[model samples]
Target: MASNVSDPAGARRPVIGLTTYLERATQGVWDVRASFLPQQYFDAVTASGGVAVLLPPQPAAQAAASVVLDGLDGLILTGGLDVQPELYGAARHPLTDPARADRDEWELALLAGARERGIPVFGICRGLQLINVAYGGTLHQHLPEALGTERYKIGGGVFAENTVDVDASTKLAGLIGAGPYGVHSYHHQGVDRLGEGLVVTARTDDGLVQAFEAPGDDYLVAVQWHPEENSADRRLFLGLVAAADAYAVSHRGVSA
Candidate 1:
């Protein structure tokens, strides 16, 4: 076990545990169905001065998810498959892809655990949806039927560029700066009903829920856009690492 002491270099780097994708993937010399994630997330965390750790899904993962979070400084719910509508008490839409139940089950557990531990959490895309569901919220299963356009998602494995209007009074406005900001979006579902203690911090011209934060002020902020996709401005990742650093300093004077 690591000691409860700070190293000048190592201690400053907060350990951010990122959720991974349990799906089929192909790479250089190997192709297999397993736990994986796009490196963009890890890269963002690393570039922002944090050590990225993978939180892989396994049997009984959720049962002990909170315990695992105790060892982490921060958590990033990365973008992935659609969440199960049944979990949110809604029927699935025709164009909606089948929900990744295994991922959903494990992530919900992680969310419950993280919230219990008061871990700093940043959710991106699917991650945002999961956060909403975890708080007893409903989802707009398909945007096309709801909005009459696929503007939010360009499909064919591409992200659409859009603008967001920020709520000036929210904490998110302080981090990313407000008003008519450009963002990268690639989702067909969005928050249809408000979650417990969640405040809408940003949205698009179409009035879809673009960003939200739980009001307790514990570094809990999630955006429908992918900040990891934009490498240049990494205030979101920086914010998470900074909060994790503070969490480490205030908790046990140690960092994973």
Candidate 2:
């Protein structure tokens, strides 16, 4: 465990856990060293006055979760490959590029454990989808086929901007404001059936679900956008880190 650092006012800084990915090849031999995530993720969290820690890919690895959860104030589920559909009782699509099943299982366990313990969580892109499926929800599998439109592209290009309508009265709306905001979209899968205790908080112009949140919770937010790609969009990390800071202050009696 790392030492807890106090802010200038003597409040303990929140520790934010960010998920990672595994590097696998089409052929044989998986190299563990190949795993990586962009540093902007850490920069975002740290910039928001939170300490960032990388949660390595260890699916079905509950021990890893326990270790990471301890001494951490929040969890951020970062983006990655498509989750294996079988975990959520669905068949894999032909286009599905399966991510690490073990890592998925571990993260799901981590999410369940975190919620039970009142830890704040921020899910982005694939992270959002994973959280939904873990809680008895399903995904579209392939957005283009499901939506019958190509207005949203999920691959191969620089980040593109799109608008997301915010649901007033939701934490997301409070953070980003009541009107539409430009967001970066880059996913083929989206929430098809919302999970229990979850509510849609934002959507694209085409009516695709862009974000959701756990009602009444201060920090369980999931969005299908890459805010880290655009730090100028400070609302994304600010909202999450602020909630996390509050959680830490309330539970641990430390100021953020």
User: Number of the top candidate by TM-score?
Assistant: 1
Misplaced by over 4 Å in model 1 are 1-11, 27-31
Give each model's whole-structure lDDT: 0.85, 0.81
**Residue pairs with backbone atoms closer than 3 Å in model 1 (clashes):** none
For each candidate, give its TM-score against the true structure: 0.92, 0.90
lDDT by residue (24-48, candidate 2, tens digit) is: 4344664445556788889999888
Q: What is the lDDT of residue 110 in candidate 1?
A: 84
What are the clashing pairs of model 2?
A: 11-255, 59-102, 59-103, 60-106
Off by over 4 Å in 2: 1-3, 7-11, 24-34
**Residue 4 alpha-carbon offset, candidate 1, angstroms:** 9.3
Please give the distance, in angstroms, between residue 229's alpha carbon in candidate 1 and its true position after superposition. Answer: 1.1
Report residue 108 deviation for candidate 2 (angstroms).
Answer: 0.4
